[model samples]
Target: MTAHAAGRYATALFELAKSSGAADAVEADLSAFRAMLDSSPELAGALASPLHAAEDKVSVLKALAEKAKFNELTLNTFGVAARNGRAGDLGKVASVYAALAAADRGVVTADVQTAAPLTKKQTEALAASLKGAFGREIEVRTDVRPELMGGLIVKVGSRMFDSSLRTKLDGMKTAMKEA
Candidate 1:
């Protein structure tokens, strides 16, 4: 249900951005917003907290958007989301918007999670490999997950490839118990 709402918000935003020739800018703004959410638990909590009124959320988001100098379309979309009480799902909406933007350019999005941050060359190599394997342009979204300990996880559409060390250790533990 939350996914559905996020999709609706993202679709509407994408259409508006597309019509205004600002899809890329909006996507960038949303991506920056998502990064902020990731970095600031207080901000994320404030947006997600039901204790706050919708109008208040709108005001806060609007202030942040203005300070960030986001595109007008992006700011308006955030205001709409906050007004609709979907501020908590803004991160998901941003992700969906990015996918929409990538699809518009005939590209596929690959969500990559690693135990540590990948270097620019490593990211490029991974993108090249994914493109070769999928026979399509690949847009890589990388996230760091130290709990993985090692290796990486990649998700492209409904398909997921998990090679993380944590999963491997768990698999081995299960096998040993069975044996």
Candidate 2:
């Protein structure tokens, strides 16, 4: 249900942004806003908290928009979400909006996890390699997972390429036991 609501909200926002020629900017704003929410539990809690009045949540979003210098469309979209009591699902909306934006631009996002953070050059190189393989432009979002021990994992939609050392070790252990 929440996912449905988020999709509706994101689709509406995406349409508005596309028509307004601000799709990219609005998407960036939403991504930034989503990242902010992810990094700030207190802020997310306040916005999603029933203890905070609806209007109060709206005001908080307005103020945060100002502080963050969010684009007009982005700010208004936040207001709409707050008014519709969908603030709690803003992150989900942002994610959906991102997917929509990427699709519109004919780009695909790859969730990449590595044992350590990649340098900008390395990121670009990997994206280039993936683009060549997938035959589509790739936007790589990266995560550092020390537990991976080494190597990387790439996930694009339902497809995944796992080269992580942890998985390799597990496979070897399984093979040994079978032997």
Candidate 3:
């Protein structure tokens, strides 16, 4: 599967970063680069486009990395991704890398969805609350999905804690129908 391949690449990158004492730095760069991919459709298209020559894609990636001032290790890792023609899976690679890094630090990630963006303080508070409940350091990734209408949904590993207004309304409708 693509995820399995991505996990292998991510493990290699994570091991390299760990041995070099730059795992945290590399993880941060991965997040930033993933964000860049999300924000730039043209860049994403170029990387994922089979029409573009691999060399050309590598050149464009190098130029963009230089402009962004990416560290040598981060740049090299991305170069490998492009060279292998796995550029479209870069985000998945980043996610896998983050998981590896967090596991190394004995932390877990929680995907949080809300109707609106949380402030930094709110995020910290949420993490603290989750830590108190789960007894593990929590890395929170928040997505603002307006369709939720209101409230928050937190997913950690196999467990989900959904308090979204949409779910509440749906439950109410089902109960009323049954009644």
Best by TM-score: 1
Model 1 lDDT per residue over 34-103, tens place: 9999999899999999999999999999999999999998898888889988999999999999999999
**Candidate 1, which ten residues in sequence have the lowest lDDT sum?**
76-85
RMSD of 1: 1.1
Candidate 1 local lDDT, residue 48: 92
Each candidate's root-mean-square deviation in Å? Answer: 1.1, 2.9, 2.6
Q: Candidate 1: lDDT over CA atoms?
A: 0.95
| 10 residues in a row with least lDDT, candidate 3 | 69-78
Where is model 3 more than 4 Å wrong at Cα? 166-179
Per-residue CA lDDT of model 3 for 1-179, tens digit only, reads 77987898899999888898888888988888888887887888888889988778778878877888776787887788889888777778988898888888899999899999999999999999999999999999888899999999999988999999999999999999999
| Residues 1-179, model 2: lDDT tens digits | 99999999999989998998999989989989988997898988887877877788889899988998988988987888888788888988988899889989899989899999999999999999999999999989887889999999999877999999999999999999999
> In candidate 2, which residue ranges exceed 4 Å CA deviation?
145-150, 165-179
Cα lDDT of candidate 3 equals 0.88
lDDT of each: 0.95, 0.90, 0.88
lDDT measured at residue 165 in model 3 versus the true structure, 0 to 100 = 100
